[model samples]
Target: MGKWTNLIKQTTDSDPISGAVNTPIQLSSTFSQADFDTYGHFDYSRSGNPTRESGERTLASLEGGKYGYLFSTGMAAISSVLFIFSSGDHLVVSKQVYGGTFRILHDVLPRFGITYDLVDFSNIEEIKKAIKPNTKALYIETPANPTLNITDISAVVALAKEQGLLTIADNTFMTPLTQRPLELGVDIVVHSATKFLAGHSDILAGVAVTNDDELAKRIYFIQNAVGATLGVTDTWLLLRGLKTLGVRYKRSSESAQTIAEHLQADKRVVQVLYPGLSSHKGYDIHQRQASSGGAVLSFDVGSLENARKVVEHLEIPIFSVSLGAVESIISYPPKMSHAELNSEELLEVGITPGLLRLSVGLEDVEDLIDDLDQALSYID
Candidate 1:
C-alpha cells in the first residue's frame, strides 16, 4: 500500500463471496434493489459499475487523491474536466500539450465560448503574464508531449493558489510512481491510461483523480452525464496492466537513458530531449519533481529526410504513433500526434519534421541502440 508496486498489485479488493484474490467484473447493466424504498450502491452501469469502481478507487489511492473517475478514452476524461467550466471562463494551458488536447482547446472549445491561452509553462514569468481575471484554471502536461519539456509543478500550483485558479496536470508520462501532482497541490490529475498504466497497448482508458471532494462531485456528474464510463472488460484489462507498471516502466526508463546517451554522442543527432540527461534544460527542475526521467524521449535527426529514413528503416521499435507500450514505438510528431497543427502552428510549438519521439520498451538497450545506429547509418 505504501510503495508503487504494492499500490498497483493490491488495488483489487478481494471478492468476499467467492474468496477470490482479484476483484471480479460486475458486467450487468442494472442491479436488483433489496427493497422498494432503498437503492443499492449502484443502479445503472453508466452511472457506476463494480469493476469501474474498483479501478477508480485504486487510481485515486495511487495518486494520493480522494476520488477518481474513469472514462472510455483519455480525451473523454479531459473533456469531462473542461465541462466543469462555463462559457466566458478562460484557462491557461501549456503550449506543448498533446495534439488532441490542443485541438479541443483551440478548435472545439472556442465554439462553445470557452477560451484558452497556450503559454510556455517552463517559464514561470510567462505563465504569470498569461493569467487574466477570467482565467479559471491552468492545464499543463509536465514532461510535455513530443518535446519532453518539464514544468515545475509546485511553483505553478503556488501561483494558481494565489490567483484562485484551479490546476490540472496530465500525469500520463510520469504515472503515479514517478510523479503525483495531487501531492504537490495540483487540484486535479488526468491520465491516458492506455500508455504506461495499461503497458500492453491494449486498452483505451482515461482517469481523473482529485483531492477536492467538491471538484470530484462535479467531475463525476460530468462523467455520468457524458456517458463515457470505461466498460467492465477494459477496466479489468487496465487492472491487469497496472500490476506490471512498476517493473515495465523501470526497465524501459533504464533503456531509454542508455539510448538517449548513445544518440547524444552521435553526430547525426542534433539534440536528444530527455530530462534524464544533464544536458537537458529542464533536468534539474525535473529531478526535483519526478522520481525518474521516465521511458519517453525525443531526438532531432537534423532534417525530415534523416528522420524519415531512421524511422522507416528501424527494425526493433514500431515506427508508429502512441507511446508507453511494452514494445518500443517511434513516432513522427509533425505527422502523427501533432498532425492537426499546420506548419505555422507546428513551428510555434517547436514540433519539427526532424524531431522523432521514442518510447523505450522492455527491450535490451544494446539491441535498441544497434537498431537505431543501423537506421541512422542509412540516413547519410
Candidate 2:
C-alpha cells in the first residue's frame, strides 16, 4: 500500500463489539477476570486500556515498529525510555535537544546516578569522544529544535551499531509520516504526540516505538510500572488526530518551505534555519534520509530587542509555546522552549536570544509570508 493509504488505514480502526467505524473509548478503570487464573487483556487502565492499546498498535505500525507505548506527556515518554538504563549507565545525547529533555538529563537523571554528555551530533567525532565504557545509548533529535540542524540518522545508527549502543531518536519534528527512524536503523523512536500526532493544541500525549522484542518488553515494563500512561479519551483523540496527519503535515510543510525561503531573502533576518532551504548545513544529508524538510523553521534577527519587536508585531501566528497545530505558532527559544538553560548554556548550544522558532500550519502561504514580513519590518 502507498504511504497515504497506510497512514489512514493504520490509524483508523473499528470497534468489534459496537460495529462502529471508530475505535470506541473504553473508560473502565478495571475489567473483570474471565476466570480465577485468567484475567482479561485489560485488567487495569494503568497497565493498559483498549483505546490506548489500539492507538499504540497504530503508532507502532505507522513507525514500522513492532511495539509502541503511549505516555501522559512527551517528557514522560522520554524519561521512561531513559529509565530503561541502569543507574551507572552513561549516554551521549545531542546538545541542542528540547529544554524539557535537557532539564531531565541535567537535573533529574543525575540524582539517579545516570550520567550523560551533551555533544554536537552533527559531528560524529564528538559523539565518539563522548562515549565512555558505561555508555549505553546515543540519543538525538534530527532537525534539532530551534536550530533545525539535521543529523545523519544512518551515520549515527551505524556508529551506535559498531559500538554496541542503543540509538534513540525523537521524531516529534518529522513525525512518522516524513521520517521513520526505525527503518533507518534507529533502535527506538519517540515523539511528543501533543505537537503533531494530536494535530490540535488541546491534548498532551507522547509515544515511544521500537522494533526489538527485548527493547519493547523493557519499554512496556517501564510504561506499566511508572503508571504515566495516556488516558482513554486522549488515546482516542490521538487516534483521530493521526488519521489526518498526512494531509496536515503536507500543507504545513509546503507553507513552511515558502516561509523559510521568504525569511532567507529578508535583510532583517540574520539567518534562516530550515532543512528545506538549500543552503541549510544539513540539506544534502537531510534529503537523503527524510522525505520532507518538516514544518518547523527557526530564524535569528540579530538581538533580543529586534526579536521582541518582530514577535510583538506578529499578527497571524500566535505567540505560544508548543507547535504543530492547525494554527501557526511562534516560539522564542530562550524563554519558551529552552528556559531551563542559562544564557551561557543556551548560546553554547546555538540557541540565541534573537532566535525564533516557527511551526508552520495549514495557512495560505502568501498570507503567512506577508504577516511575517509585516512583523519583521518592525525590527529595523
Candidate 3:
C-alpha cells in the first residue's frame, strides 16, 4: 500500500491554463466551441467536467482500470453499471448485500423485466447452481455489508468468464487500496466513494471503474443520459480525500482489528464478525486477497435491548447511518442500513435484532476500546 500512497499523491497535472499544482474545479456548465464545425473535448457539464474527469482518472488509475465514471450517489454508480443489462436479462447477486442494493434488485428492476437470484457466495457451488441461460451478469459484494462475508473473487470471475457473463464487484468496503477487483479479472468495479474513498462524511459521491472500453462507454453514456453526474465541488472534495486514503485506512484498520478482538473476548458480546479475526470464517481467504481486514466490523450484543443501550450510551462513535469517516460510526444494521428487510428476511441474511456495525475511525484505539467497554457495561 505504500505504492498506492505514492500513486494517490501524484496530482493530475491537468491545469493547462493555470499550471496549478492542485486540480482546478471547472465550474462552467458549457465549454466554448473552437469552430463552427467542431467542438472541444468537453461540450457539456453533464457529459464531462474537468473536475469530475480528474477524480475519475485518479480512481481509474488506482483500481488499475481503463476508465472511471463519477456519479451523484453510490446507488447511481451501481445503477449505471446495471443499466447495461436490458429487459429480460438476469443477474446473479450475493445473498447479503447492502439494503439499498437489495431493494433495487427486489423492488425496482423487476418492473423492467430484469430478474435476479440472491445466492450465498460463501459457497461457490451455490453461485454455479444459480446461473441459468438468461443470466448475463454476476454482481458481488465481498466482505459483504454488515455481515463481513468474504467471497473468492478469482473463483467467481473465472466461473463468470467460463459462463460468458460479465463480473461486477462492489469494492466500497475494501476500496482499491486493499482489493482491486479489476486486476483480479472483474469487468467492473463500483464504489460508494462517499465512504472510505472520501475518508470523511462531508460529501456524497460514487464511482464505477472498468478495464473494458465498451462497458466504460456504456456507463459514461448512462451517466450523462441519466443525469446523475457528480457536481464540481464534491468531485474536488473526493480528490482531496483520495490523497490521504492510504494513511487513513491503515490507521483505521488497525483500530478496527483491535476493537473486533476486544468485543470478541467480552462475555456480553455474542459474536464479532471481522475478517481480521482468526475465528471469522472468511479470515484466511480475506487475508489472501486483501492487504488488510479493512476499517469496518460487526458484532452482536445478544439482545435488542442490549444493542439499544449500547448505542444510547456510546460517547465517541456517532450512532449514525453511513460508515468510514473521521469519526467512528456505530450503527444498528437491522434498523439502519438493512431496514428495508422484514424480521424474517433479516434472519435469513444473518442480520439479527442485536447486530451492530462499527466503522472504525481515526480515533485512538485505546479511546475507542474504553468508550465501547463503558457502553457495553450498560448491557448488564
Candidate 4:
C-alpha cells in the first residue's frame, strides 16, 4: 500500500474498469526504474514485482506487521525462519504439528548439526523442563496440527520473552482475522497461504510477516539468496483468494460446527476433535486466544477398516491430503499426511489409521451429513 492506509482502501477495492484493482497477472520480469524513480528498486521479478508487492503489503497490513514476504510454499517460508539459526543452535518445537514441519525439524535440520526438541507445549512445565542452553527459538502451532491440542499463547510468549528466545508461530489455520500472534508477544508469524489464508485451493503459496526490521532483512536476504519467492501470477491469485477469505472462513466454520455436533453423537465415532466443540481439550484455550474455532476437525471411526470404508464411500467430502479449500475433504493422517512418523509415534499422537481429518467447506450442512452418513454405513 506504499506505506499508506489510503492506498489499502484503493488497492483492495475492485478496479473501476473491471472491478479488480490488482492488475490481471502482471508477469513482466524486469522494470525500468528510471521511468518510475531515479533510484533502482524491484528491477527484477525474482527480486520483486508490483503484483507480489501489493499482496505482501495487503498481508502485512492485515497482520499488523511492518513487512511481509511471499514464498513458493508454506514450507519455504517456514524454512526461511531457520536461516536465523546455524549448527550447534537448538530449536524448541511442538510435537503435534504439521507432518511437513515435523520432518523438517527432526530430519532435515539435524543434518546441519542443529538440534531440536519436540515438546508438549500444552504443559508450560514441559517446555520449561525441555529448554537447553542452546535453544534459539521456540516454535509453536497453537490448536496444534491433527491432535488439536492448544498451548496458552500468553504463557508461551511470556516464557520465550524471558528466555531471550525468538518466538515463531504458524498462523495458517487461524489466519490474521482470527488470531494475531504478532500482537501477543510473538516475533514472527508464518502462514501456508495454500490453506486458510488464501481461502481457496487455486494457488500454492506461503507468507511471513514480522514487525522486526532486522528479522525482515534476514528473511529478505534468505528469499533472495535461496530464491524461493512465489510467482507473480500465484501472488495475484493469492491476493484474489485473500479478498474473500473472511466470508469463506465464516461459512466453512459454520458448517464445521454443525458437522462436529452431528458426528459427536454418532455411536460409530470414538471421538470428534474440533476446537469449536465445548468438549474439545483445547476449547477453552483456543477461545481465549482465537476469535473463532477453525473449520478443520478430526474424528475417528471405531476401527482402521471402518475408516477406510468411510473415506471410500463419502460423496461430499473429497478424499485428499491437503486442507483449507472450497470443497469438503477427508484424510487418513497415518497413511496420508503423517506417513513419515513411525508407528509408535503415530499412535502416541492418536493418529491411528482410523483417524479421518475432515476439512469443512462452504457446503450445505445437510448434504455433507447425508454423504457422511452413507459413507459410515459402508464401514460396517
Better of 2 and 4 by lDDT: 2
Q: How accurate is candidate 1 locally (lDDT)?
A: 0.92
Clashing pairs in 4: 14-19, 14-20, 15-19, 15-20, 15-21
**Tens-digit per-residue lDDT, 195-215, candidate 1:** 999989898999999989899
Off-target runs (Cα >4 Å) in candidate 3 are 12-14
Candidate 2 residue spans exceeding 4 A from truth: none
For all candidates in order, the CA lDDT equals 0.92, 0.93, 0.91, 0.84
Worst lDDT run of 10 residues, candidate 4, spans: 2-11
What is candidate 3's lDDT per residue for 1-380, written digit by digit as tens? 46565565554444778777679988899999999999889999998998888889888888888898999999999988888889999999998999999989999899999999999988889999999899999999999999999999999999999999999999999988889888889999999999998978999999999988888888988899999999989998888888888889989999999999889999999999999999999988898889899999999999899999999999999999999898999999988999999999999989988999999999899999999999999998
Which candidate gets the maximum lDDT versus the true structure? 2
RMSD of each: 1.0, 0.8, 1.2, 3.2
- Tens-digit lDDT track of model 2 for 122-238: 999999999999999999899899888889999999999999999999999999888989999999999999998998998999999999999999999999999999998999899
How should the candidates be ordered by lDDT, best one leading?
Answer: 2, 1, 3, 4
- In order of appearance, the predictions have TM-scores of 0.98, 0.99, 0.98, 0.93
TM-score of 4: 0.93
Give the 10-residue window scoring lowest on summed lDDT in candidate 3.
5-14
